[model samples]
Target chain A: MLTKRIIPCLDIKDGRTVKGVNFVNIRDAGDPVELGSAYAQQGADELVFLDISATNEERKTFASLVRDIAKHINIPFTVGGGISAVADVAPLLEAGADKVSVNSAAVRNPGLIDELSKAFGAQCIVLAIDARRVDDQWTVHTHGGKKATEKKLFEWAKEGQDRGAGEILFTSMDHDGTKSGFAIDPLARLNAILSIPVIASGGAGNKEHFIGAFKEGKADAALAASIFHFGEVKIPELKSFLKQQAIHIR
Target chain B: MKLAIIKYNAGNIQSVSFALERLGVDFHITDNAEEIKTADKVIFPGVGEASTTMKYLRDRKLDLVIRDLKQPVLGICLGMQLMCTFSEENATECLGIFDESVKLFKPTAQDQKVPHMGWNQLRLKDSWLDPSLEGEFIYFVHSYYVPVNPNTAASTDYIVPFSAAMKRDNFHAVQFHPEKSAEAGERVLKSFLK
Candidate 1:
């Protein structure tokens, strides 16, 4: 059986991890590779390193960091953030990232999705949609959810899939950071309409929330940051709990 | 062992090189037919479209070299698919190392997704792969699969039972990415290295 994946997302800035990580055994919390290896050791199904760096030099450093991570961590990982053009992706993939997620740039230029999918097989291109409910409609947001776009969630997601995105990483801005729960309705709808896998992101506070994402949202995978980093919810314990709940966790 | 990673116009070759480096094995990535043919072991790693990659392999005449190699040759992902007789992906013919046809995955259930991405357990049926890896999860990412055949060494279930790993004489192939499958994956690679 294909198991439901549990992913730990780490934010990278200037070649180092940002946002406080509370892993006790970590020698350097800023080291994304070490932290990523630690997470992989704890049975993280996969890892996502979102490079939040702003400058070109920092992006170079991030690419080098990706090479180091690939050399050390055995698990598959995705690299995202600041990936605007097709050229920006090769460096990351060449550095050994399994997948590369494009957000704001993809929204601005929908053709970018097609080009990316054509260049690198659809399996490596992840379309990340950040959206929030507005006027009873899910409106897509860009630039890390600060800027709003006219595209609606479902239509844009369908378009992304048609444009050859292998998977959709949908992050509900409304429920994000609230620690309340996942945006079940939207996630369920995305799965219902699209044939590709949908990874539910944001609003993962506890283990039950993960269960909800899998059971209710019907998410192929669930991703969370602070909860895993702060040791509030360990992956092994979470997987065991999900298994007890009859969820096919790996 | 003099290991040579067969390099073609495919993606994710770096990941395999890194995996070998982690194992502390010296290897060279090359398209040289003589180098690949003379190596003790050859790793054919790929992540790309089938027809195009097959064309690239044919253009360089690496196809003939690969077909003639007598050493242990392991194929990964598209490399595995190309080892088969044919592929439903763009209707391209393959190397015919394995007498099987690669077909696209058709979802029978609503939950079954294409690209069959993420970790899934393997059912080992041969000694080429470590028996300890039985029921252990490995990473896979592909829309096309080679169905179970006599060459199947390991099997996995998604929409249907498919060949997770296939072995025929000297050529071995796996649909999963052992380079990215963590420790269990490392063990599989170690088994191949042995």
Candidate 2:
């Protein structure tokens, strides 16, 4: 049986691990490679590194950091942030990152999703959607949740799947950094609408939140950054808790 | 032992190379038939669309080279799928080493995702891989799967019971990405190298 995944996301800035609170007030964590390796050791099913840096030089540094992470970490990992074109993805994949997540670029040109999935194969392309409830509708947000778009959550997700995105990493901007719980209603709806796996992100405060994400939200995976980064929630303990809850955790 | 990773127009080949590097083994990623033929063991790794990759292999005659190689060869993910008789992916014929067909996964339940992504446990039987890895979770990501057959060395259940790993003579293939499966996955590679 395929078990539910527990992912530890490391927000990267200037090639180092950082955690942003609601997309701002970044705090330094540690070296990405070290943190990634430690997470792997702690039984993290997968790792996601989101590069929050903007400069072209920092992008180069992130690629090299990706190579280093790939060399040290044995488990699968995904790299995302500011991926705008096919050219932008080639370096990261060549650097040995297993998958690359595309956000703003994919939304701007939905064809970018088609082109990426065609070129890199759908298995390696993750469509990451940051969304918040605006006036009773789940509105899509981009640029790290700073900009809102006209696209609705469910429709854009369906389009992403049709365009060949292998997985949807849906982060709820409303629930992010609040540590209350996952946005279950929206996540469940996303899972119901999309055939590909949906990874529930944001609002993971404790192990119970994870259970809600998997059992109620029906997420194939649950991702958290601050909790895992600061040792507030240890992965092994959480996995055991989920397993006890009959979640079939990996 | 001389080891060669057969290089083709496929994705994730770099990950395999890095995995071997972590294992402290010397290897060459090559498409040259002579190198692949002479190597004591060969690793055929790929991640891409079936028809396109098969065409790439056939264009370089790597398909024929792979089919004829007597050295123990291990194929991963799409590499494993292409080793089969045919693939439902674009209805393309494959290398025909395993005599199995790869079919797209049709989810039976709402939770059964098409790609079958994430870590899944394996039920091993007469596998060249480490027997201790039985019931251990290995990473998998593919929409299509090779159904259980005579060559199945290991099996996993998702939407349906499928070949997690298969073995027939010198050709050994796994649908999972052992390179990205961490320690247990490294054990699989080590078992093959042994």
Interface RMSD of each: 0.7, 0.7
* Candidate 2 clashing pairs, residues 3+ apart or interchain: none
DockQ scores of all models, one per candidate = 0.88, 0.88
lDDT of all predictions, in order shown? 0.93, 0.91
Question: Candidate 2 on A23-135: residue-level lDDT in tens?
Answer: 21233336788778878988999999999997988878898999999999999999999898999999899989989999999989999999999889888899999999999
Report the C-alpha lDDT of model 1 over B33-92, residue by residue, as the tens digit. Answer: 889989999999989999999999999999999999999999999999999999999999
Q: Mind sharing the TM-score for model 2?
A: 0.97
Could you give me the TM-score of model 1 versus the true structure?
0.99
Cα error, residue A53 of model 2, in Å, equals 0.7
lDDT of 1 by residue, A1-250 (tens): 9999999999999989998999989899989999999999999999999999888888889989988999899999999999989899988898899999999999989999999999998999999999998899999999889899999999999999999999999999999999999999999999999999999998999999998899989999999999999999999999999999999988
Error of 2 at A208 (Å): 0.9
TM-score winner: 1
